[model samples]
Target: MAVPAPSAPAATASFTNAGPAGFWQRAAAWSLDAALVAPFAGWLAWPWIAAPAQAWLDQVRALLQHTGQTMGAAIIDGASLPRLAITLLHDPALHQATAAIRSATWAMVWPALLACALLGAIYHVAGECSPWQASPGKRLLGLHAADRRGRRLGTGRALARYSAGALSWATLNLGHLMATAAPEHLALHDRCSDTRVRAARTGLPRWARAWLVLLAIAGLVASAWLAQAAGTVMQAALERALFWPG
Candidate 1:
């Protein structure tokens, strides 16, 4: 009698050998990857961004001159500050300028945003499908993506996982937050792609932690500079609007 055929290996076994990565670990990896790609994407999109930005700045300058002239005359004629502010708010020219600037700014930036997104997608897909089964950032964090059987993903599967990440963003990042609550800390995209971000026994490297600290410090300094610049601009504009020769 012929022996029974060997049973096929179960494909549904969960790959739980390593613990799933936490949300903060995944976020840090993504931030590192974004920082790596941002410069190249900015360079590629500069041409599209520059011209419209210049045009918008020119329009803003013209509006500032017109506003100073209009408001200076009103102030000289003894108009109360409250009334002048109300009149300025109701000015058709001011409204037109606001709308024009908004449109121009959006036009100036969409190409750059698109370029960055495309580059990021390419970077993530290639890295995930590579032998390391992780991007440079993820590898730095000791993380890897694997299928249900803990196998490295093929190119197609990696691409699918990346594509499904759009859903995570589309949900306003609620899908990403799901990882905090889900069993094994699997994110929505991880579930959709039948993959998980697994952490190695090792923790984040010292260099990676230092990089994050420096990045935070730089961000804080930049924000402070921007705030000071904006305050100065407003002060200058107010002075011009109030004291311009009428």
Candidate 2:
């Protein structure tokens, strides 16, 4: 009789929890990741957004030219050009045009979305394959992502895990909430990818975690401030084009 080769190990029906992280800890880790990733994603999207911004500025110029032509017609008709121009400055058309240009700028959302995905891949995929088996946020929160057997995931598996994470987001976070419902406390992505985020045997010191949290908050504040400044500049430029058209 020929000797038979051993069969592959059978898959388990349910994973042991092993002190898996609950929803709140995972949410906190995700929040920290968002804060850390936003600036980098914004930087990556700047070049793509610049084109849309410029197009919007051009549209503003075109609208202003149209308004100027209307004012010129009123002057030629001897229709009290100064009064007509003053009224045109507050015309509903100008307000609508401004809104449309802003909408055009907002249309660069696709590139920004791609930048966000890439940043998440760099943070989660690469980090999970590393010796720590966790991203910075996860590490700070004392969580380690690993395969069912508690082994660090290879790069391919890590990428799969990252891609699955999109489903969690796309489903309005119901997939994420699965972690709270699942017996193993695994998110949809984790369950599908055969991974789990268990409490690490050891984590960063308390002082280090505190500093990281502070930095994340600071980054969020800085990003918000920069966005406000950019919006102000754009609004001012639009106003000049509308009222002081060349």
Candidate 3:
């Protein structure tokens, strides 16, 4: 009887030739991720933000009261735009008001901004390093981050990629725009980190397209509502300031 031939081990598959993701795809994914992360970041930063925000509001009210008293009810009630502008420009209190507003605004904003940045960094780094090789937003869009060999990124490489993304922002986003023209569709951070965002599919799925459309509609509606509400509030504040008892 003849001896059976030994079988060879199966070779592992290399990276697919799905190509690099388009700029719009990457942008959409980032936007989605930002939306998902913003609420949590805001919640975490609220404790630090609330006091400064309240202080800023108080300063604004005081400034308005001072302005009303200085300009007097006559000029304000008449709604003389030029006179109002001239008075505001020459008022010494305006300088102090402006300074206080700037200081309070910065104090209220910085903590929230820092929280968002830190949380975003952690989210991106961990997601890219995971077995899925993509953040939830990227995965939803059928995109993944990988090395040249199509291997998933390590934690260090993912972190490096996330950090280098700051360069893209610092460049006024010209670094990010490079993806549109680059032969391989690689952005500055992608090149700096030796990584790529690959599209697992040719185009967006129907569900993603629908979701984007709905999101756009919702955003438009929210913006319109906010603008109307803001206008109403400003009108009310102006009326109160002009008519308030001395």
Best model number under lDDT: 3
TM-score (all chains, Cα) for each model: 0.78, 0.57, 0.75
Model 1: per-residue Cα lDDT at residue 140: 78
Q: What is the RMSD, in Å, between candidate 2 and the native fold over all Cα?
A: 9.9
Cα displacement (angstroms), candidate 3, residue 17, comes to 1.4
Candidate 1 per-residue C-alpha lDDT over 1-246 given as tens digits, one digit per residue, 9 for 90 to 100: 997754322321222456878887787788899889999998999989989889887777656756766666676778999988998899999888888888888988898889988998899988887767789988878788888878878889998898899899999999899888745888889999999898875356677678778889999999999767655555566577676553
The 10-residue segment with the lowest total lDDT in model 2: 8-17
In candidate 3, position 213 carries an lDDT of 88
Best by TM-score: 1
lDDT of 1: 0.80
Give residue 95's error in model 3 in angstroms. Answer: 3.9
Global lDDT of each candidate:
0.80, 0.74, 0.80
Which residue pairs come into collision in candidate 1? none
Give per-model CA RMSD: 7.2, 9.9, 5.8
Of the candidates numbered 1 and 2, which has the greater TM-score value? Answer: 1
Pairs clashing in candidate 3?
none
State the lDDT of candidate 3 residue by residue for 1-246, as single tens digits.
Answer: 997754321111222666788887787788789899999999999999999999887777667656656555546568487877787888888779878988999999999989998999899988988777889999788788989878878889999999899899999999899888755789999999999998876666777677778789999999999767655555565566567745
